[model samples]
Target: MFQVALTGLLTGLALIIAVGAQNAFLLRQGIRGEQVLPIVLTCLLSDVVAITAGVFGLGIVLERWPSVLPVAQVLGGVYLIAFGVHAAMRAWRPGTLDAGDGTAMTTGRAIMLTLALTWLNPHFYLDAVLMLGTVANSFGADRWWFLAGTLVASVLWFFGLGFGARLLRGIFARPTAWRVLDSGIAVVMGTLGVGLLAH
Candidate 1:
Protein backbone atom coordinates (compact mmCIF):
# COMPACT_ATOMS: atom_id res chain seq x y z
CA MET A 1 0.00 0.00 0.00
CA PHE A 2 2.80 2.39 0.88
CA GLN A 3 4.59 1.76 -2.36
CA VAL A 4 1.42 1.97 -4.39
CA ALA A 5 0.46 5.24 -2.75
CA LEU A 6 3.95 6.55 -3.31
CA THR A 7 3.66 5.69 -6.96
CA GLY A 8 0.39 7.55 -7.16
CA LEU A 9 1.92 10.59 -5.47
CA LEU A 10 4.86 10.68 -7.83
CA THR A 11 2.61 10.22 -10.82
CA GLY A 12 0.25 12.99 -9.73
CA LEU A 13 3.12 15.42 -9.19
CA ALA A 14 4.65 14.52 -12.53
CA LEU A 15 1.47 15.54 -14.26
CA ILE A 16 0.45 18.48 -12.03
CA ILE A 17 3.76 20.25 -11.63
CA ALA A 18 4.06 22.01 -14.96
CA VAL A 19 3.73 25.44 -16.60
CA GLY A 20 0.10 25.12 -17.58
CA ALA A 21 -2.71 27.64 -17.81
CA GLN A 22 -4.05 26.72 -14.42
CA ASN A 23 -0.69 27.10 -12.71
CA ALA A 24 0.02 30.37 -14.44
CA PHE A 25 -3.29 31.89 -13.48
CA LEU A 26 -2.92 30.73 -9.92
CA LEU A 27 0.58 32.08 -9.69
CA ARG A 28 -0.57 35.45 -10.98
CA GLN A 29 -3.34 35.61 -8.43
CA GLY A 30 -1.04 34.55 -5.64
CA ILE A 31 1.54 37.16 -6.50
CA ARG A 32 -1.02 39.88 -6.94
CA GLY A 33 -2.55 39.09 -3.54
CA GLU A 34 -6.00 38.66 -4.97
CA GLN A 35 -8.44 35.98 -3.83
CA VAL A 36 -5.64 33.55 -3.18
CA LEU A 37 -7.58 31.43 -0.70
CA PRO A 38 -10.67 30.95 -2.84
CA ILE A 39 -8.58 30.33 -5.92
CA VAL A 40 -6.52 27.73 -4.12
CA LEU A 41 -9.61 26.04 -2.75
CA THR A 42 -11.16 26.10 -6.17
CA CYS A 43 -8.14 24.37 -7.62
CA LEU A 44 -7.96 21.83 -4.79
CA LEU A 45 -11.63 20.93 -4.94
CA SER A 46 -11.61 20.74 -8.72
CA ASP A 47 -8.71 18.33 -8.62
CA VAL A 48 -10.43 16.27 -5.94
CA VAL A 49 -13.54 15.91 -8.06
CA ALA A 50 -11.60 15.23 -11.24
CA ILE A 51 -9.20 12.70 -9.77
CA THR A 52 -11.98 11.09 -7.78
CA ALA A 53 -14.06 10.70 -10.92
CA GLY A 54 -11.10 9.15 -12.64
CA VAL A 55 -10.23 6.80 -9.82
CA PHE A 56 -13.75 5.51 -9.31
CA GLY A 57 -14.90 4.95 -12.93
CA LEU A 58 -15.41 7.90 -15.30
CA GLY A 59 -12.42 6.79 -17.32
CA ILE A 60 -14.32 3.74 -18.50
CA VAL A 61 -17.23 5.80 -19.70
CA LEU A 62 -14.88 8.14 -21.56
CA GLU A 63 -13.05 5.20 -23.09
CA ARG A 64 -16.24 3.72 -24.43
CA TRP A 65 -17.44 7.09 -25.73
CA PRO A 66 -14.30 8.35 -27.33
CA SER A 67 -16.34 10.82 -29.36
CA VAL A 68 -16.71 13.12 -26.37
CA LEU A 69 -13.08 14.21 -26.37
CA PRO A 70 -13.10 15.94 -29.74
CA VAL A 71 -16.01 18.16 -28.77
CA ALA A 72 -14.15 19.08 -25.62
CA GLN A 73 -11.06 19.68 -27.66
CA VAL A 74 -12.76 22.24 -29.89
CA LEU A 75 -14.47 24.13 -27.13
CA GLY A 76 -11.41 24.06 -24.93
CA GLY A 77 -9.14 25.11 -27.72
CA VAL A 78 -11.18 28.18 -28.59
CA TYR A 79 -11.50 29.21 -24.98
CA LEU A 80 -7.80 28.82 -24.39
CA ILE A 81 -6.99 30.97 -27.38
CA ALA A 82 -9.30 33.72 -26.24
CA PHE A 83 -7.79 33.56 -22.79
CA GLY A 84 -4.31 33.69 -24.26
CA VAL A 85 -5.23 36.81 -26.18
CA HIS A 86 -6.42 38.39 -22.97
CA ALA A 87 -3.12 37.53 -21.33
CA ALA A 88 -1.27 39.03 -24.26
CA MET A 89 -3.22 42.22 -23.89
CA ARG A 90 -2.30 42.36 -20.25
CA ALA A 91 1.33 41.83 -21.11
CA TRP A 92 1.22 44.58 -23.67
CA ARG A 93 0.07 47.10 -21.11
CA PRO A 94 0.50 45.88 -17.60
CA GLY A 95 -0.73 48.27 -14.94
CA THR A 96 0.03 48.79 -11.29
CA LEU A 97 -0.57 45.71 -9.19
CA ASP A 98 -2.81 47.60 -6.83
CA ALA A 99 -4.56 49.36 -9.67
CA GLY A 100 -4.94 47.27 -12.79
CA ASP A 101 -5.70 50.46 -14.72
CA GLY A 102 -9.26 50.22 -13.43
CA THR A 103 -9.57 46.66 -14.71
CA ALA A 104 -9.39 44.75 -11.52
CA MET A 105 -8.99 41.01 -11.62
CA THR A 106 -11.86 40.64 -9.18
CA THR A 107 -12.72 37.60 -7.14
CA GLY A 108 -15.91 36.75 -8.98
CA ARG A 109 -14.32 37.08 -12.38
CA ALA A 110 -11.28 35.17 -11.23
CA ILE A 111 -13.39 32.33 -9.87
CA MET A 112 -15.44 32.15 -13.02
CA LEU A 113 -12.31 32.13 -15.15
CA THR A 114 -10.88 29.41 -12.98
CA LEU A 115 -14.00 27.30 -13.51
CA ALA A 116 -13.82 27.81 -17.25
CA LEU A 117 -10.14 26.95 -17.27
CA THR A 118 -10.79 23.87 -15.18
CA TRP A 119 -13.81 22.48 -17.01
CA LEU A 120 -13.38 23.68 -20.58
CA ASN A 121 -9.87 22.31 -20.98
CA PRO A 122 -9.83 18.84 -22.53
CA HIS A 123 -6.20 18.38 -21.56
CA PHE A 124 -7.21 18.55 -17.92
CA TYR A 125 -9.84 15.91 -18.39
CA LEU A 126 -7.38 13.76 -20.26
CA ASP A 127 -4.82 13.99 -17.49
CA ALA A 128 -7.15 13.66 -14.51
CA VAL A 129 -9.76 11.34 -15.91
CA LEU A 130 -8.26 9.18 -18.61
CA MET A 131 -4.59 8.98 -17.72
CA LEU A 132 -4.85 8.98 -13.95
CA GLY A 133 -7.86 6.71 -14.04
CA THR A 134 -5.98 4.18 -16.11
CA VAL A 135 -3.16 4.33 -13.62
CA ALA A 136 -5.30 4.03 -10.47
CA ASN A 137 -7.26 1.14 -11.90
CA SER A 138 -4.06 -0.80 -12.22
CA PHE A 139 -3.88 -0.96 -8.45
CA GLY A 140 -6.92 -3.20 -8.40
CA ALA A 141 -8.10 -3.71 -4.83
CA ASP A 142 -5.71 -1.06 -3.58
CA ARG A 143 -6.96 1.66 -5.85
CA TRP A 144 -8.29 3.53 -2.82
CA TRP A 145 -4.76 3.95 -1.58
CA PHE A 146 -3.80 5.28 -4.94
CA LEU A 147 -6.65 7.75 -4.82
CA ALA A 148 -5.55 8.92 -1.39
CA GLY A 149 -2.06 9.43 -2.65
CA THR A 150 -3.20 11.53 -5.57
CA LEU A 151 -5.49 13.57 -3.35
CA VAL A 152 -2.57 14.30 -1.05
CA ALA A 153 -0.53 15.41 -3.98
CA SER A 154 -3.23 17.80 -5.16
CA VAL A 155 -3.69 19.26 -1.71
CA LEU A 156 -0.01 19.81 -1.19
CA TRP A 157 0.58 21.29 -4.60
CA PHE A 158 -2.33 23.73 -4.68
CA PHE A 159 -1.65 24.92 -1.17
CA GLY A 160 2.03 25.27 -1.77
CA LEU A 161 1.64 27.10 -5.06
CA GLY A 162 -1.09 29.42 -3.92
CA PHE A 163 0.63 30.39 -0.69
CA GLY A 164 4.24 30.02 -1.65
CA ALA A 165 3.83 32.34 -4.60
CA ARG A 166 3.38 35.20 -2.17
CA LEU A 167 7.04 34.80 -1.35
CA LEU A 168 7.91 36.28 -4.74
CA ARG A 169 5.72 39.33 -4.31
CA GLY A 170 8.75 41.50 -3.90
CA ILE A 171 9.92 40.78 -7.42
CA PHE A 172 6.55 41.45 -9.03
CA ALA A 173 6.50 45.01 -7.73
CA ARG A 174 7.79 46.20 -11.06
CA PRO A 175 5.59 46.39 -14.13
CA THR A 176 8.26 44.69 -16.20
CA ALA A 177 7.93 41.56 -14.14
CA TRP A 178 4.22 41.56 -14.72
CA ARG A 179 4.78 41.94 -18.45
CA VAL A 180 7.21 39.07 -18.53
CA LEU A 181 4.93 36.79 -16.55
CA ASP A 182 1.89 37.65 -18.65
CA SER A 183 3.93 37.17 -21.82
CA GLY A 184 4.93 33.70 -20.68
CA ILE A 185 1.33 32.94 -19.79
CA ALA A 186 0.18 34.14 -23.19
CA VAL A 187 2.66 31.90 -24.94
CA VAL A 188 1.81 28.83 -22.92
CA MET A 189 -1.93 29.30 -23.20
CA GLY A 190 -1.71 30.02 -26.90
CA THR A 191 0.46 26.98 -27.59
CA LEU A 192 -1.77 24.66 -25.63
CA GLY A 193 -4.85 26.10 -27.26
CA VAL A 194 -3.42 25.55 -30.70
CA GLY A 195 -2.35 22.03 -29.83
CA LEU A 196 -5.83 21.17 -28.65
CA LEU A 197 -7.32 22.54 -31.83
CA ALA A 198 -4.89 20.62 -33.98
CA HIS A 199 -5.49 17.46 -32.04
Candidate 2:
Protein backbone atom coordinates (compact mmCIF):
# COMPACT_ATOMS: atom_id res chain seq x y z
CA MET A 1 0.00 0.00 0.00
CA PHE A 2 2.78 2.37 0.90
CA GLN A 3 4.61 1.63 -2.31
CA VAL A 4 1.47 2.11 -4.33
CA ALA A 5 0.75 5.40 -2.63
CA LEU A 6 4.27 6.68 -3.18
CA THR A 7 4.25 5.69 -6.83
CA GLY A 8 0.92 7.37 -7.42
CA LEU A 9 2.02 10.54 -5.67
CA LEU A 10 5.21 10.76 -7.69
CA THR A 11 3.42 10.11 -10.95
CA GLY A 12 0.76 12.70 -10.21
CA LEU A 13 3.31 15.29 -9.24
CA ALA A 14 5.42 14.65 -12.31
CA LEU A 15 2.55 15.13 -14.72
CA ILE A 16 1.19 18.19 -12.96
CA ILE A 17 4.61 19.87 -12.93
CA ALA A 18 4.74 19.91 -16.71
CA VAL A 19 4.01 23.32 -18.28
CA GLY A 20 1.06 22.38 -20.41
CA ALA A 21 -1.67 24.53 -21.97
CA GLN A 22 -4.05 24.20 -19.06
CA ASN A 23 -1.37 25.02 -16.55
CA ALA A 24 -0.11 27.94 -18.59
CA PHE A 25 -3.61 29.33 -18.71
CA LEU A 26 -4.00 28.73 -15.01
CA LEU A 27 -0.83 30.61 -14.25
CA ARG A 28 -1.78 33.49 -16.50
CA GLN A 29 -5.18 33.73 -14.89
CA GLY A 30 -3.52 33.57 -11.52
CA ILE A 31 -1.19 36.42 -12.42
CA ARG A 32 -4.11 38.44 -13.64
CA GLY A 33 -6.00 37.63 -10.48
CA GLU A 34 -9.09 36.57 -12.38
CA GLN A 35 -11.62 34.00 -11.28
CA VAL A 36 -8.79 31.96 -9.91
CA LEU A 37 -10.71 29.65 -7.62
CA PRO A 38 -13.32 28.70 -10.18
CA ILE A 39 -10.73 28.04 -12.85
CA VAL A 40 -8.58 26.02 -10.52
CA LEU A 41 -11.48 23.99 -9.22
CA THR A 42 -12.61 23.20 -12.74
CA CYS A 43 -9.15 22.02 -13.67
CA LEU A 44 -8.89 19.83 -10.59
CA LEU A 45 -12.32 18.38 -11.17
CA SER A 46 -11.51 17.62 -14.75
CA ASP A 47 -8.45 15.74 -13.63
CA VAL A 48 -10.48 13.77 -11.13
CA VAL A 49 -12.92 12.71 -13.82
CA ALA A 50 -10.22 11.77 -16.29
CA ILE A 51 -8.09 10.01 -13.69
CA THR A 52 -11.09 8.09 -12.49
CA ALA A 53 -11.89 6.96 -15.99
CA GLY A 54 -8.33 5.77 -16.48
CA VAL A 55 -8.00 4.01 -13.13
CA PHE A 56 -11.27 2.23 -13.80
CA GLY A 57 -9.76 0.49 -16.85
CA LEU A 58 -10.82 2.97 -19.51
CA GLY A 59 -7.16 3.49 -20.29
CA ILE A 60 -7.01 0.00 -21.74
CA VAL A 61 -9.68 0.96 -24.20
CA LEU A 62 -7.85 4.15 -25.11
CA GLU A 63 -4.65 2.16 -25.68
CA ARG A 64 -6.52 -0.05 -28.10
CA TRP A 65 -7.73 3.00 -30.04
CA PRO A 66 -4.59 3.82 -31.93
CA SER A 67 -6.19 6.28 -34.32
CA VAL A 68 -7.80 8.14 -31.45
CA LEU A 69 -4.57 8.57 -29.57
CA PRO A 70 -2.58 9.78 -32.58
CA VAL A 71 -5.20 12.27 -33.68
CA ALA A 72 -5.58 13.50 -30.17
CA GLN A 73 -1.85 13.80 -29.75
CA VAL A 74 -1.50 15.78 -32.89
CA LEU A 75 -4.37 18.14 -32.20
CA GLY A 76 -3.56 18.55 -28.56
CA GLY A 77 0.11 19.07 -29.28
CA VAL A 78 -0.67 21.69 -31.88
CA TYR A 79 -2.99 23.50 -29.48
CA LEU A 80 -0.40 23.44 -26.73
CA ILE A 81 2.34 24.80 -28.97
CA ALA A 82 0.06 27.51 -30.30
CA PHE A 83 -1.06 28.44 -26.81
CA GLY A 84 2.56 28.66 -25.71
CA VAL A 85 3.43 30.96 -28.57
CA HIS A 86 0.44 33.14 -27.81
CA ALA A 87 1.49 33.37 -24.18
CA ALA A 88 4.96 34.40 -25.25
CA MET A 89 3.51 37.09 -27.45
CA ARG A 90 1.35 38.34 -24.61
CA ALA A 91 4.42 38.59 -22.47
CA TRP A 92 6.25 40.45 -25.22
CA ARG A 93 3.38 42.89 -25.64
CA PRO A 94 1.60 43.97 -22.55
CA GLY A 95 -2.05 44.80 -23.12
CA THR A 96 -3.98 47.66 -21.56
CA LEU A 97 -6.73 46.64 -19.22
CA ASP A 98 -10.15 48.25 -19.74
CA ALA A 99 -11.71 46.51 -16.75
CA GLY A 100 -10.96 47.42 -13.19
CA ASP A 101 -11.25 45.64 -9.78
CA GLY A 102 -8.93 42.92 -11.11
CA THR A 103 -11.75 40.59 -12.05
CA ALA A 104 -11.61 39.73 -15.72
CA MET A 105 -13.31 36.33 -15.61
CA THR A 106 -16.75 35.00 -14.82
CA THR A 107 -17.80 31.65 -13.36
CA GLY A 108 -19.52 30.41 -16.48
CA ARG A 109 -16.71 31.45 -18.76
CA ALA A 110 -14.14 30.08 -16.39
CA ILE A 111 -15.83 26.69 -16.26
CA MET A 112 -16.06 26.41 -20.01
CA LEU A 113 -12.51 27.54 -20.60
CA THR A 114 -11.06 25.32 -17.92
CA LEU A 115 -13.07 22.34 -19.08
CA ALA A 116 -12.03 22.79 -22.67
CA LEU A 117 -8.38 23.28 -21.77
CA THR A 118 -8.30 20.34 -19.40
CA TRP A 119 -10.58 17.90 -21.17
CA LEU A 120 -9.90 18.63 -24.82
CA ASN A 121 -6.19 17.91 -24.49
CA PRO A 122 -5.62 14.30 -25.46
CA HIS A 123 -2.31 14.42 -23.66
CA PHE A 124 -4.24 14.63 -20.42
CA TYR A 125 -5.93 11.34 -21.18
CA LEU A 126 -2.71 9.70 -22.27
CA ASP A 127 -0.61 10.87 -19.37
CA ALA A 128 -2.87 11.14 -16.37
CA VAL A 129 -5.66 8.73 -17.13
CA LEU A 130 -3.94 6.02 -19.11
CA MET A 131 -0.30 6.02 -18.07
CA LEU A 132 -0.99 6.75 -14.43
CA GLY A 133 -3.83 4.27 -14.44
CA THR A 134 -1.59 1.59 -15.85
CA VAL A 135 0.85 2.18 -13.04
CA ALA A 136 -1.90 1.98 -10.44
CA ASN A 137 -3.37 -1.13 -12.01
CA SER A 138 -0.09 -2.96 -11.62
CA PHE A 139 -0.79 -3.02 -7.93
CA GLY A 140 -4.09 -4.89 -8.33
CA ALA A 141 -6.12 -4.36 -5.16
CA ASP A 142 -3.72 -1.67 -4.09
CA ARG A 143 -4.84 0.38 -7.05
CA TRP A 144 -7.56 2.01 -4.97
CA TRP A 145 -5.10 3.21 -2.40
CA PHE A 146 -2.79 4.48 -5.11
CA LEU A 147 -5.57 6.42 -6.76
CA ALA A 148 -6.63 7.93 -3.45
CA GLY A 149 -3.15 9.15 -2.81
CA THR A 150 -2.92 10.56 -6.31
CA LEU A 151 -6.22 12.42 -5.91
CA VAL A 152 -4.96 13.98 -2.72
CA ALA A 153 -1.85 15.17 -4.48
CA SER A 154 -3.92 16.63 -7.28
CA VAL A 155 -6.09 18.55 -4.84
CA LEU A 156 -3.08 19.89 -3.03
CA TRP A 157 -1.35 20.95 -6.23
CA PHE A 158 -4.37 22.72 -7.74
CA PHE A 159 -5.17 24.61 -4.57
CA GLY A 160 -1.58 25.64 -4.13
CA LEU A 161 -1.38 26.90 -7.69
CA GLY A 162 -4.65 28.85 -7.44
CA PHE A 163 -4.34 30.46 -4.06
CA GLY A 164 -0.60 30.67 -3.91
CA ALA A 165 -0.48 32.90 -6.96
CA ARG A 166 -1.93 35.64 -4.75
CA LEU A 167 1.41 35.82 -3.00
CA LEU A 168 3.04 36.77 -6.30
CA ARG A 169 0.42 39.33 -7.29
CA GLY A 170 2.80 42.17 -6.56
CA ILE A 171 5.38 40.86 -8.99
CA PHE A 172 2.74 40.52 -11.66
CA ALA A 173 1.88 44.19 -11.31
CA ARG A 174 4.96 44.86 -13.40
CA PRO A 175 4.81 44.25 -17.14
CA THR A 176 8.31 42.80 -17.18
CA ALA A 177 7.23 39.91 -15.02
CA TRP A 178 4.50 38.95 -17.47
CA ARG A 179 7.03 38.97 -20.27
CA VAL A 180 9.34 36.66 -18.39
CA LEU A 181 6.59 34.28 -17.35
CA ASP A 182 5.03 34.05 -20.80
CA SER A 183 8.39 33.59 -22.50
CA GLY A 184 9.29 30.78 -20.13
CA ILE A 185 5.86 29.25 -20.65
CA ALA A 186 6.35 29.28 -24.40
CA VAL A 187 9.70 27.52 -24.13
CA VAL A 188 8.35 24.86 -21.83
CA MET A 189 5.23 24.19 -23.88
CA GLY A 190 7.16 24.11 -27.12
CA THR A 191 9.65 21.67 -25.68
CA LEU A 192 6.89 19.43 -24.39
CA GLY A 193 5.17 19.46 -27.77
CA VAL A 194 8.32 18.66 -29.72
CA GLY A 195 9.14 15.90 -27.29
CA LEU A 196 5.67 14.43 -27.59
CA LEU A 197 5.84 14.47 -31.36
CA ALA A 198 9.22 12.81 -31.26
CA HIS A 199 7.73 10.05 -29.15
Best-performing candidate as measured by lDDT: 1
Off-target runs (Cα >4 Å) in candidate 1 are: 96-103
Cα shift from native, residue 43, model 1 (Å): 1.1
Q: What is the lDDT of every predicted structure here? A: 0.86, 0.77
Candidate 1 lDDT, 32-109, residue by residue in tens = 777888888888889999999998899999999999989988998898899899989988986633323313667788
Q: What's each prediction's clash count?
A: 0, 0
lDDT of 2 at 153: 81
What lDDT tens digits, residue by residue, belong to model 2 across residues 1-199? Answer: 8878888888788889776778777877776778888888898888788888888999989878767877766766676677677767776676742112555567798788778667657788888888888988988989988898788888888888877877877877777777778788888777766655665
Report residue 120 deviation for candidate 2 (angstroms): 3.1
